[model samples]
Target: MPSPEETVKLVQQSMAVYVKPREQAEHVRRVIAYHLQSTVEGSRPGGPLCLIDASANISEPYQGIRGATQEFFKASAANSKALEEFETVRKAHTQLNQPAGPVIKPNRYEILDDKLHLINQQEKSARLGTLERHIDILSEKPATNPDFLSLKPIFKDLRPLVKVPREIVDSLAMDENADRRDLASLVEKLDKVLLKSKLLLTREEQYLQTLKSQISLDPRSVTPSAKARALDTTRNELINWIESELSKASTNADDSDAGHDSDSSHGPSTSGEKPGEEDEVAKKTRQTIMTKLGTVKESYQLYVAARKSLVAALKEPVSMSARPVAEPPVRQPQESPATTEGSSGTASYLLLPYLSKLSELTAAQKAVIAYKSHFNVALAKQLKEACQIIDHLVPESQLLPQFPWPASERAKHLNPGSLDHLTAAVSDQPDLSSQIKPWVFASDSARIATMETVAESIEDGQVGIESINKTLTEIASLFGEVNGDSASISQGDPWADLALDLGLLGPKPRP
Candidate 1:
């Protein structure tokens, strides 16, 4: 029910409510990691690996927060999915309005009634002749004509519903029957004979109603203006539903966050390490990491906002000229101005509105494209920076469990005798994260090969802007951008599928 502008504002506000707290939680995790890294830097050989305990304590709760945030974003992404569905339905409605040639089928009930009347008339005529011949003293021949041919075709059209065998109906028509009881028996069963026919007619009516509703046209009655209004109402309701869901999700997030905060306050510190033990450098590192995390989070929020704004803008109705223009009549060599003046004047008036709307829509389209391109470039850069920081700080060798990578070359350095000591020792290695990536590749060689083939097959500029952004995010999340390069090798989701959905490529045509 809300206006488009109001709905967009509500969505933005709802997203922000969920996003802000999540950003804070992410910042806290980064701070803990930064401080632990500083502690690891200063620790002596053979001494306790105290930083490991700090990392473990912070990680458990942060994992929960991260999961909640991911769910919130996933729910928010549903709005985009809803919009896509609306667009598909809208397109189908547009197709329904397009000029289809004259239909062969009329109201099924009308056709059936007419066929029944013709058959009944023949039966009545034959009966009258039989009765008349009963008292005939003045006839040369008591002619009894039973029209079996016409009745047979009508019965055939009714199909399995008209269960009377062709032979039985033919016998009733061709053979003269004077007994009223015999003729009455066939007349009485006609309703039973057309039971399936009635059911089929009902089904046809229901189907027609479905098509009418989908295209926002009334089956009972419809005019051009009424159809347009119906379409507008449908569009508004879809947008309203999207906004309502977003609002509900935001409210639920707030309630969940409130409970989480209450529990955190009452709960004892779950960290392995005691508090007040971190050095000055470790404390400073925590503060610095928090600041950087905030910056990254803000950049991400900005990116999300821009994308939503584009979606909102696209939802507003584009004034399309739906009616077809008739081709102008060919002019005689010396046609008078007055003769053509009325039609030409009318066309000019119609075209002015259409051309104006087209120009406006075109300009809006260009603006949207420019904005999206710029935003994507910025977002890609931000993702690259964030990934670099995460990769540099979090040691992947320490992250993975030992059993899963027993024979992995990356795990060879990890000793069973002093697992904790080995973990801490490997965390210091500069190339440890880089080494882990090779292990991933080795483990998922077949999947990697498939993904690579898909990526290679995809031609450039084939993917939709939205899908491309999503793909980039997935890539960054799984395998952070390395060496300032935005390109990444994905372990899931073929790049070719994304291109195919965008209509840039399709299945190869058969010969």
Candidate 2:
């Protein structure tokens, strides 16, 4: 019963109520709870009514999010009536030029599922995403050395890996208390070693700085080569220790063949002790360990490189030279279009076809927007969507989803004699090579099929104010100025004006 504007305002207000992107499930739960509460009370707040429609169904979109909970997605079959009128509210979002996400049917989970707290799906999902993101951030070229304070929060998160809470362990059917405790002890050792390594790295850096300063002030105070060797030996010992600790991670018979890697992509290949007992928590803990170990290893390598570079510079002194005078840059002359560049210059305009079609699509969309009560609005919308779809089905990308399209199946088999004959015949027929080509996704086939469908729809039209072509012609005619002057476009239909200028359309009829 709400207006489109009211619906959009409500949707924004509800979604804007400070829900994290990953916490959308909790948001949905709250929204549905609010909906039920408000419905019973007959009090509609601007908040929950945002995502609600005339049918009162909520839309849940989970794809593309890293740790999205699939179990929470609302199924439509539970309520057929609710989703039928949901599109009106969604259409209002489109009117505002914003995506309303997917409009799915509300499922029975809202009423049936009371074990929400026991399941930890949303919380686990959000935390897993955070862990993965942490790994990813570490993988990138770090701006600064990995600090202990920053990782303190992560260590707290990793605590679950060591000590599984009684409630979670009971619900998830975790390993026996003894085995979990052993695994916890091993992880706790690795964490302690890592903390020690961070402290050791800080001390080594300070030591290196002192050595460099002593050598710079008194050339004979310290041997650059000796100091560099000592620095590397200590760092390598610590690095190897970290590596050895990581290598001790539990490996099952099946997973024993896997390699221990510092790369986040191959995060913690080995699981906890007794792989049979290892759950998602154990796996995540190992991954987080590997990620931290990886950062430490990287810091070590960086320190060694910087120390070595500084040592090498100290060993070899370079005499300063005068700077060379800079020369002015020479700009090349622009080529004229009249010159025959042989497709080199023209390749940039490959998107011109899509651009032209897009122009027409925008005009059609605008026409529909201006006259919402247009007789052919539905047809126009279909055409607009089809045009957009067709535009995106670019060359070679939109291949008919085929599986196991092997080399033999993909290649056309022709005899040597037949090939020779065909090649000879291609001299007679210039288009033969293109006609009898190897397998590839055809560009024109999809466009033609889509155009044919549009053509059929235009023909049927359910009887338009003027037929489809008549409307287009009427639109085109608007570009024709008074006294048949093609110089000035009268009604401002750029497409029509373009067609007239290009001589694609005939002269307009005189009034």
lDDT score at residue 88, model 1, on the 0-100 scale: 75
lDDT tens digits, residue span 337-402, model 2? 122133323432454577589999989966764454343345434655665554455344434433
Give me the runs in candidate 1 sitting further than 4 Å from their true place.
1-338, 396-511
lDDT of each: 0.54, 0.52
Candidate 2, position 122, lDDT: 79
Candidate 1 lDDT over 1-511, as tens digits, reads 4466875685576456444576886785565545545555755336322223211222222344344344433444554454555567568756765568875768999999999999999999999998888657444443433454456857776647647798888877844556556667686355333533454455568878998778864566766455654444443344334445755765775565567555444444665553343334445655675577556545544543444344444554656757454443333323333333454455555556876899999899668756655664465456557657656644554434322444554455444555544554533323334445544654576566678888866644456666888888787655434333655445454543333335565443333
Using lDDT, give the best candidate's number: 1
TM-score of each: 0.16, 0.15
Clash count per candidate: 0, 2
Assess candidate 2 and give its lDDT: 0.52
Report the error of model 1 at residue 425, Å. Answer: 36
Top candidate when judged by TM-score against the true structure: 1
| Candidate 2 least-lDDT 10 residues | 331-340
